[model samples]
Target: MSAAPSPAPPRETRQREVISRLLQSAEGPLGVPELHARALNELPRLGVATVYRTLKLLQEQGAAHIVTLDGENLYEASGRGHHHHFSCRQCGRVYTLNTCPVALPAGTVYPGGFVVEAHEVTLYGLCPACAPR
Candidate 1:
């Protein structure tokens, strides 16, 4: 049987537009503070709460992805799945890795009969610009 359709997302607002623009223009995941700061350029009234709420709504709608780095919750635009990310230690820049390095042999199973559904990998290092001259 076909699955039931999901409810439509909430109506768009100026804050949502600002948050969406920031997320889409970002090269990697962004935290609430960063999103709010950048959004202020176009939306001076943008607040942290609005950014958080918009991010939550976007995530629930599968329009964004939540990434956790060092216990920090970050959000990024969706559609870049099945890959990994790279973070520069020197400059604190995050880059997308087009390759996925996870491979499991056939018949592989968890110790408690658990199933592997998905995984994410984050690499840390210096970017080309940040590398030693």
Candidate 2:
């Protein structure tokens, strides 16, 4: 008897949905709990572990990113290749800047033989609403 074909990959579907909700929500970055809760709205049985796993997959495929700032791990959409980020301390909000100010002359900063694949730029401070006078 012939062996039955393997089932389709569920991780891909879950990962796509995860990335879609993240971009549509546009909440800068979200923690696992927050992301998982949101995913549950569409997928009632979504689990936190699945959320983490899918997020890792998304990061590996360059579809999303995880930012660890001030002891918090947050996830965000990353289809624009790579970019910088700004997060508010008081309000606990996050923002993605259009570009980074820090720049290095090509072939100077990086090691002679090493290749620079990607970089993460992050800044943390009080946002406009949370700033103190």
Candidate 3:
């Protein structure tokens, strides 16, 4: 038999570690600029390019995923499990909604035999902090 495949090398660098920690601890998904700015607090010398590269690596490794809101891309750590997102129209902050309201049964089929593999729902409104009483 051929030699066993060698284990993949670790991709975690100081910059990557800082970025990962920020993503993991964030209250919700963050855009690239936001992520970069937050990472600079921990790693002053960190470059935005490094943040983009680290995010790509994380996405490739399935440790992170992207959510598009209001035509902008935001990143969040994976493993949150079957959740959705909400955005505040006033403050432009995105929040994670842990409950799913859609009740589409598994293997949902639509017109033209289209199979629904997955779904994402984004609700738009003012968040609690931004809402007027």
Q: After superposition, how far is residue 84 of candidate 2 from its true place, in Å?
A: 1.1
Model 3 lDDT per residue over 36-118, tens place: 99988888888889899999999988999998887899999999999889989998888889999898766999999999888
Question: By lDDT, who's the top model here?
Answer: 3
User: For model 3, what is the alpha-carbon lDDT of residue 72?
Assistant: 91
lDDT of each: 0.82, 0.72, 0.90
TM-score of each: 0.79, 0.65, 0.89
Mark the regions of model 2 whose C-alpha exceeds 4 Å error after superposition: 1-19, 23-25, 110-119
**Model 2 C-alpha lDDT per residue in residues 26-85, reported as the tens digit of each score:** 747777877777777778887777787787877876777767877888888876544677
lDDT of 2 at 60: 74
lDDT of 1 by residue, 2-92 (tens): 9899877689888887788778878788878777889999988777787878888998888898888878888889987577889899987
RMSD of each: 4.3, 4.7, 1.9
Which is the winner by lDDT between candidate 1 and candidate 2? 1
CA shift of 63, model 3, Å: 0.5
Error of 1 at 41 (Å): 1.2
TM-score of candidate 3 relative to the true fold: 0.89
